[model samples]
Target: MRQLSELDASFLYLESANAPMHIGSIYLFDASERETPLAFSTFVSYLRSRLHVVPVFRQRLKEIPLRMGHPYWIDDPDFSIERHLAYVSLGENSREASLMTLASKILEEPLKRDRPLWHITFVDGFQLGGDKEGNPGFALIVKLHHAAIDAFSGAEIMGKLLEYTPKPQPISAPRPWQPRPKPSEERVMLQAGANILRTPWRVTSIAAGAVEATARGLIQKQLRRIPLSFPLFTAPHSPFNRQITANRQIVSAKLDLSRLKAIKATLGDVTLNDVVLGLCAETLRRYLGDQNASNDESLVAMTPLSVRSSTLNRTTGNQMSAMLLDLATNEQNPAKRIRRIHWNAVASEPYREAIAADRLTELLPSAMLALSARLYSELQIAQRYQPVFNLPITNIPGPQVPLYLQGARLVQQYNAAPLFDSMGLVIVAVSYQGSLTLNFTMCPDVVAKGNSLRNHAYASLDAIEQAASMLDPEDMHTPLEETRSQSMADSAMNLLEGSLKKLTSRLRR
Candidate 1:
């Protein structure tokens, strides 16, 4: 049996009814490409044939006696592909909004612990609504527990499951399945006891490493004379950091990837990620402005970073870190916000705290890690702290080439990441083919205005696109566009300043 790493196991302990720890993606397939319409049975057969490609699909978690340790993955003797796959019909309504709502409903509950932590729901009879009305297409809703894979690993697994060619290639014959016998409770208990004994030295090593890294970070910060970004708990309380509930609402919008690339090209020194964050900043700015909330303070976003090496690309489990960066939502200029975000991301990489946290996870025993997480959850420590970050912004790079399931051509793909304690919003951006899809998962209890946020996301994209179009390569504005663009910027800044002044006055009183 292979034991779960602390980072993987923490997802288990962090899970509660109010916060389900799983992330998933939705894949839309255009069935018109196929000579015959793609059926659910055909998709199931495809998944079954490729089941051996990813071992995690057949493995189930086994707990130690008395919960003394983290769970282990063992091949399930009774594993059935049918158990993990199901079919859902959209019925009368097959609009994109309806599909998102159905997807949210499907993911409302936590995955069953008794089975493999991944489930697939094949949605049939969805209308793409092209030149032909009721042109039947289909969608595949894939949900995988966080313990099984991070976004990077999950993307790799997706590539493994799909094909580069529409013509189905014959899969290799599977080797005979030999199930390993389950370990006895006494053996597991004894093993847990031994692991507990070694915890101190392991923890000591981790602490030393963290201290060294932190010291290096501090020295780097001092030499650069750049103040560290806003610390956790410093983020002003917003609707995003309230008590969360299980009820969730999900929505998505797509941005032209070429336009994003053009923005990066036009803004010479900016990266695609910088452009993405700039859009998110504007989205939050508009969203907060609508709520009559203050945008004077910058909001912090916990951005996930991939730690996987090229050699370990095929390996599963979590090998990720996170960085906290100020979103600069208060900045009214789109161009300036993008540049600042780029610089902040570059400066903050050297001081990433998530690496130290990951190191601690690597050294600490599972039981100890789980215990600490349990305490943090049960005691509601998040409420006491201001908030480590306002929300999580994750960007997963997907295949630029088209992926196919049997003969159906994959069209649009969107993804949603699970929300953690007090984190009401998680923005997952995934680029497929030439489109970047922004999927938002919000806890209804905290972010009651989910639909509004979704609309603002699209609006922000439009604003950024407009801003990028107006700027010349030299950052000089043509006489014709300069006046109009400047007017727009000035108008926004005036309103923002007025709002900030009022907020300051209210706080002073």
Candidate 2:
């Protein structure tokens, strides 16, 4: 049986009813045809075929005795799609708040471990009657354990399940499902013996790498001592930096990536990631400003970096390390904040080194990794360091073209990820079909204006887009000049007033 990685097992052990240890996506589909083109059963059949090659999709946990090894994937004999899928239609009086309430109820309960450790619910016959043209649509909510796949790999797997164009017919039926036969005791013993023999060399190599990494970290720290003096590098103390609740909140917004790309091109040398972080930083600035909250301190965000190589694309589990980014929201100008974020991104070398060390730790024996993980958990339980960051922010790239699921046209996609013990907010950005959708999931108590924060995120993008258009030589700064127009000023004032109202309502509530 293949064992769980230290990162993977930690997610399993830390799960609770309030905080389900799973990440999920919600897809809203709009179909042109009047008739229901894809029956729910047909979609299930397609999913079953996809699961044959992607075994993790169909298997559940097979926990082994002792933390000596990782959990095994056993074929779920009692698997039922009905238990996992749900069908729902919003009534005339339903509000977004009600939808959020329902979502919270769904998220509060942890996934059953005895089953395939994953589930997908199809919510059909949804009609928002807004800018969506009153089309009847459905929502697909998929939940998979953090142990199963990290964000990047998860996106890749999702792309595989979808098709750019509709297939004339569904693929042929999959072969009968089968469990992996258990190995003989003799073979198990021989493998254990071999592992024991190779343990010393692996252990030695790990030690050597740790020493080298430590030396490098020290040298880099010394070289960058001056710029690191800011609170940007130091950990902050807040209520969020404590043992976490087993609960989550997920909300999403979609923005045009091409517009963002235009901004980046005009900015020169700034990356797409920099623009994303900049937007978040600006949003936080406006959010706190509207709430009359303190703005002296910078916000720390834990940004996950994928260390996976091309060859390891299909591999599952976490191969990620995080860099604590100081969202220098104290800076008033958006462009300047963008530049500062870019520099801070460059200076976050030590965290990358720490992540590299983590990669080495994973190559050791399962027992060793488990012991180390337990010790790490104990340290967290004790609350050793001041919490290093405020929230976790991740960006996962998705397909550039529209994708279809069982013939329903996917309009928007959003992701919800876990918040660690010390973090209360997670902002995950998924780029699909030329738009960058930002999903903001946070503790309701911590984020007083959650919906406003979502709006501010989009507003920040609008501000950047305007600035970039102004800087463009060909565009003649027409859009930027228009910002000063009576109509534009009035619109901006209205938005600011609306946001203030929302913030006040949230705080009072």
Candidate 3:
């Protein structure tokens, strides 16, 4: 049995009934090429045979008596894979929209603490992808608690579960699992006491390191003259920045990856991520404008950045940090926002070393941190003050090549991440094959019309693309004019110019 790191246990403590701390994905796969249809029984047997590869699949969390220390991952004595699997047939209602709606509800429910913190559901009857209507496909929805695995590690587990080749590999013989006896209450208490004794030394070292890190970060920021957004400091409250309800709504939008890359190619000194952030900024600006909400101030986003490569000897748990970003949502021309975003990311990159997750986890006492998180949620402090960051945006990079599950080639992949109080919305982007899918998860009460927002994203990206095409390849770094005409007629003419250019290019092609 292994004790959960401070970073991992923090997720457990921070979770509330309204905010279930789990992350998951919806995958659409084509199984028509298989000799026989992929049956629920066959899939269950297939998953059961691979349990040895991921030991955490069968283990459940066991807390210490009176929560004296972090929880332990103990093998569930009564473990049964049957209890963790389910099958559903959508039949005629198996459209992608129906599937996403169902996924939202499943993702909101909390996982049972009595069992392993993961579950899977096999969905049949999804419509065929691309041409060939008769080509059969199915959807798979899987959820795992954030405490067990973050997005990066989840991808590692997926690499273990899926295959790189179309040819199915032979399943190995079942290896029996042995369950160790649960630790006695006395032993658990003693372990907690030992951990408590060691905290003083850890705190001392962590405190010293934190001060040094802060000073170093300040020096770098001043030397570079870069503006960075910090939690509760620069973020201004917005219409959606409030405590969220239990209910949630979800929507998925797909776009061509090549087009985003083309924008990056046309624009020098800007990363592809800058283009994605620009899309989000413009999309949200239009969304709020459509609702008649004020867009006077640019919205901020809390983007999660993985630090796995920088971290040393990190076998498991979360290895990430977040930085606040000014999305420049108020920019009149959505196409012009990428340059500002590029600058924002560049300025924020230097500050990452100061707030790395690994260092913070070492400094903070787990028990104290857990209590503080629980108290913060219960007291509703998030409602009283400015939010830490508006919402989380996770950009997950996926394999460009096709990945197969039991010989079924994956055609589409959508991601879903957890939400918390005062943070109603979260965006997850996954690029696979040649497409990038953006999944919007939000509380319906806080952010209405999730689909409407998604539709706006399409229009926003189109505007950006048209404007990008008009940019000159040489001297691409020329500043896009920041000032926009306030008159409606001038705005209309500007849009018309881009639209006509897009039409001409289409005709030329």
Which candidate do you rate higher for lDDT, 1 or 3?
Answer: 1
TM-score of each: 0.83, 0.76, 0.83
Ranking by lDDT: 1, 3, 2
> Model 2, 1-509: lDDT tens per residue?
66566577767765655457788777677655436645567767777667655667766776543333456665566666566666565553443444555565566567888787677776655553364346666666777788888887778777777767743346677768766665555655555455546543333333433454464456455644533232222445544455556556676777889877877787776788988889877877787788786677777776788888888635567777655566777667686567667766754443334333144344444443444434434445224454446677898888888888766677778788876555667789889889998888776765666778778888898887776555545432222211111132223334434654564354334
Off by over 4 Å in 1: 130-132, 169-175, 200-232, 349-357, 360-368, 466-509
Q: Give the per-residue lDDT of model 1 (tens digit) for 303-375.
A: 8789889887355788887666777786787766787777666644333333333543554445445555555
The best candidate by lDDT is 1
**TM-score of candidate 1 on Cα atoms, chains taken together:** 0.83
Better of 2 and 3 by lDDT: 3
C-alpha lDDT of all candidate models, in order: 0.74, 0.64, 0.73
Candidate number with the higher TM-score (2 or 3): 3
Candidate 2, position 158, lDDT: 79
Q: In candidate 3, which residue pairs clash?
A: none
